[model samples]
Target: MPSAPGTGKGGGPDHGYPPVGRLLPVGGGVVHALTTGSGPDVVLLHGASGNLRDFTFDLVGRLARDFRVTAFDRPGLGHSDPLHADGESPAEQAAVLDAAAGMLGLGRAVIVGHSFGGSVAMAWALEHPERVAAVVTLAGATMPWPGDLGPWYRIASTTFGAATVVPLVSGWLPDSYARNSVASIFAPQQPPDGYLEHVGIPLTLRRAAVLRSNVRQVAGLKPHVAAMARRYPGLSIPVEIVHGTADTIVPAAVHAHPMSRLLPNARLTKLPGIGHMPHHVAPDATLAAIRSAAVRAGLN
Candidate 1:
């Protein structure tokens, strides 16, 4: 099954900026995505267990003002179909993204990737340097998978492999399961209402293929980060990393800290009292970091 277009309503048109919606077919599946506003291109990638909409709504709208904001549902998430085979690794996903960019007439784009999306964007930039104008990673995981996993996580991963069974067993999962899961990623502060309902449930239900591919990608992170780190010194483009000091999902010490140290020209921003999903918890700060990176890239 190829990726498909998004079926839900996107943001309404504002100030004559046409509402953006599209489903571009690439390879076996179609990639559901949207493009809004106009100028230099900026591609937004969502993290694990999330779709493009995971970005704070206001942030997306704000970014669309300066750059042609492009966001998409990865394979098997939202309206996009999952990978048809086991070959849909991070590198392969990057290839699809490159093809999508070409199809969209974006020759070069500033890639703003969140969490796992950051990994994808980095891999894409590494593979096709010419197509990337700059790179920004938000709470990205750029390290090896953790050796220790609680029993629940192990079980969840195993069950996610058999996600076809999720609908059948969703009843057994507590109502607060998804909400609590996302809440744990942040500090003690509660996230916006409907956060999990809007972002989490649909993802778990719609993104089985991507979830499976992520298992493999997570396992391969160490080598990938190491290889990419070696290439960073060769990169002249601007790279910015934003992470939360209190992030529990992808620890700052293990992921962002090492990444910031390795990349020769990288700038790192650590948000106080923030957590994994900084884009949601601190949209203003995230947007500021993005604007700063864009300025550094001479796109602003």
Candidate 2:
């Protein structure tokens, strides 16, 4: 278990963004979950360096109008406790979050994941098919890419970086630089107004644990996805893959395109001129994909 909120101790960073819903103690660590609306279950997982707030910013509110939406802060990202000092594998993350969902008494759910969260969603469906009604990946990083993730990720995941560099960067990183980084992620298409404040960039930048965990997870993601991809053909559940043609982070050519072909039952929706944040860039399309997944899974 970790320390309480706002303590800034063994727990996550105290960014003053309190939990909007409840916290669940499962697998010996706490997970933060925001549940809303009422209907068939919908579990949302955000991408790397993001908390549940990513969905709560807009998508979850709209989805809540029709479905019972539960947006969770994946282990170590937000209010949730880190599974371990080393970056947690997607399967490890899925295991802890699934336990949290079970504690909430949620039945089979339409699992929706964004960016890195998409990998976690796939892992969840792979590990606990009985608990997942379907899956939706919004600009998800589902497949292994061909190149490295750059020097930042490479260094951040190292022992020396985690012990010294992470703390140093966290201590002195300027807000402007962080904002610029966010902008770069949404390049070609600017981020929506107030996304930075709403999503809590400080929470991610200021927390050494969060930064270290994120880098480790990202650094180790390619191999994980490669192994996971080998089993995609065996996954028979409905999968709605919503990707952007313009996504540079997880290029559609590298991931979504090949993944659509591999999955036995998958519908790919390619949004033209959209970026990595498809959920935010094109919420209507994202919502439609989720709804489609629900219908295909016999939930609607």
lDDT of 1 by residue, 162-247 (tens): 46443344435566666667677666567787666445354443334444444444444556666666776676778889998888
Which candidate's lDDT is highest? 2
Off by over 4 Å in 1: 1-20, 145-172, 206-223
Task: Evaluate all candidate structures by whole-model CA lDDT and list the values in order.
Answer: 0.68, 0.88
> Candidate 2, residues 37-115: lDDT per residue as tens digits?
9999999999998999999889988998999999998887878878888788899999998989988889999999999
Off by over 4 Å in 2: 1-3, 8-13
Q: Give the lowest summed-lDDT range of ten residues in model 1.
A: 10-19
Clashes in model 1: which pairs? 2-28, 2-29, 2-30, 3-29, 3-30, 76-81, 76-82
TM-score of each: 0.83, 0.97
* Cα distance off (Å), candidate 2, residue 14: 1.4
In model 2, what is the error at residue 237, expressed in angstroms? Answer: 0.7
Displacement of residue 277 (Cα, Å) in model 1 is 1.4
RMSD of 2: 1.4
